[model samples]
Target: MSIPFLAGAVSKLFLQFGCSEVRVEGLPAFVERLKGDRGVLTIANHISVVDEPTMWGVLPISTFYDQRTVRWTLGASDMMFNNTFDSWFFTKGQIIETFRGKGIYQKAIDTARAKLDEGRWIHIFPEGKIKQDTLTELRRFKWGVSRMLMESKGGRGEEAPLIIPIWIKGFEEVMNEEREFPRFLPRTGKKVTVIIGEPINDAIEPLLAEYQRKFPHPWVPITYGRDVQEDLKEEPPQLAEMRSKIAEAMRQELMKLGQRVPEVEAREPTKIEWNW
Candidate 1:
């Protein structure tokens, strides 16, 4: 069986056992807005490890715009691409393994650009890492998305990619990073809600301007690294400034989209124990 079909099948099974109900809002309108051969970039918040499979189950699999629009997503190389089975499964799901610390991330970006050139949808989690807090609390976004947008504009000009913001809720409740198996028979069935916001082609400028107004600084362009605990003391000032600005912009936009859903009381923290 093909990888996509396998993934779809597994996702469907998970939906049956893991999720009690799936609610998708604003998908029809977002799908209707897709036109021509323009590239689409979908951004969403990361809450749980099962978020990807949940998305695969809920989103329209093969019927986007009456054509099979290819989908591509980014996965951590060390986390998802190290084992043979994992590599195969993720690859079949169109996930491109990306090495976080290595300079190889540029390769992933190039691959994504190539796919976008072919009018495919690229999905990314701008938060870099999943948030362990409440559903309403969004972590700061990474600068990689802004860099992707800038690169796409430079390459595609007027046909630059369309950015779609999506907010997902309830995946964390089903299975968080701390759990290997989901609670199949919880008191309340798992319910996941996905809300897609309007598309925006001209987001960078406004987002950046708002970020600057909120946090004034003399900015410069810098490569934003993935690790939140990294010491920036040794980095060049300009690069650090630039990366911070871009990350701030992306975070603001995501926060705006996240506000569409009402905040819920913080779920009990997940406890993890390492056996090593």
Candidate 2:
């Protein structure tokens, strides 16, 4: 399948913006992994806006094209969603919004199921927001990812979409600010690296057991009026500790599958948590 002309055009935009080389490797393995008639759900670390595009450049556009897997993206904010000029790449990449109201949660569930059925490649940041002023700790993984996967497994009766965790390094420097506004600053001498991890099954028995031991109750009929921020704040310290474990597991897995990065100068963050 020939790449859409826009792909090449977009490739140059990254180059023109001080992206010296968008290096791509492990494509053969990734292509082979996808050729088996399975959709993919990539959970990528959201550091900078450049993170996804760099991964897009490294990925085989032709394979993703043939699969008809629209690269779905979940933005961290309304502003991030609204400011995006590129909607041609995602199924509904505009805003990662979910409808609210009476009995509407099921609709959101159904939307996730339908996306998988369409054989689309969905991208989510498990953190749900970018980590600014902190690099050492990953925010807890939102239950939405686990919920979507569990629902998909039960609905399809086949292996769910291949879950790929991508660890992106160096974008924090390139974009270097909490929000998007600071990203456009004059380009400094910085480089970025994106490491793609191998796929995993979200419904694995061990993972479910792990969740049970941690969250205890899987489903509850809670009212909608409660603030979600308060709910998230209620998470136990165990959850945060467990989250770091999961993120490190994924990071290590990514490092194993990715290339040995060349020795490059990295701008260490003020606060750093070494994953290795």
All-Cα superposition RMSD per candidate: 8.6, 8.2
State the weakest 10-residue window (summed lDDT) of model 1. Answer: 267-276
Clashes of each: 2, 1
lDDT of each: 0.62, 0.51
- Residues 1-276 of candidate 1: C-alpha lDDT, one tens digit per residue: 566655655665666555666666676576555544777888889987767755655545443223335467888889888889999888877888787874312567668767776677888888887786876667767656655654454222336667778888887776655664444432237776777887754655554444344435422225443343343554445444655665565566767887866532133222111111
Off by over 4 Å in 2: 1-8, 11-17, 21-25, 61-67, 80-96, 99-109, 132-136, 154-157, 178-189, 202-205, 208-276
TM-score of 1: 0.73
Q: Which residue pairs show collisions in model 1?
A: 221-239, 222-239
Estimate candidate 1's RMSD in Å. 8.6
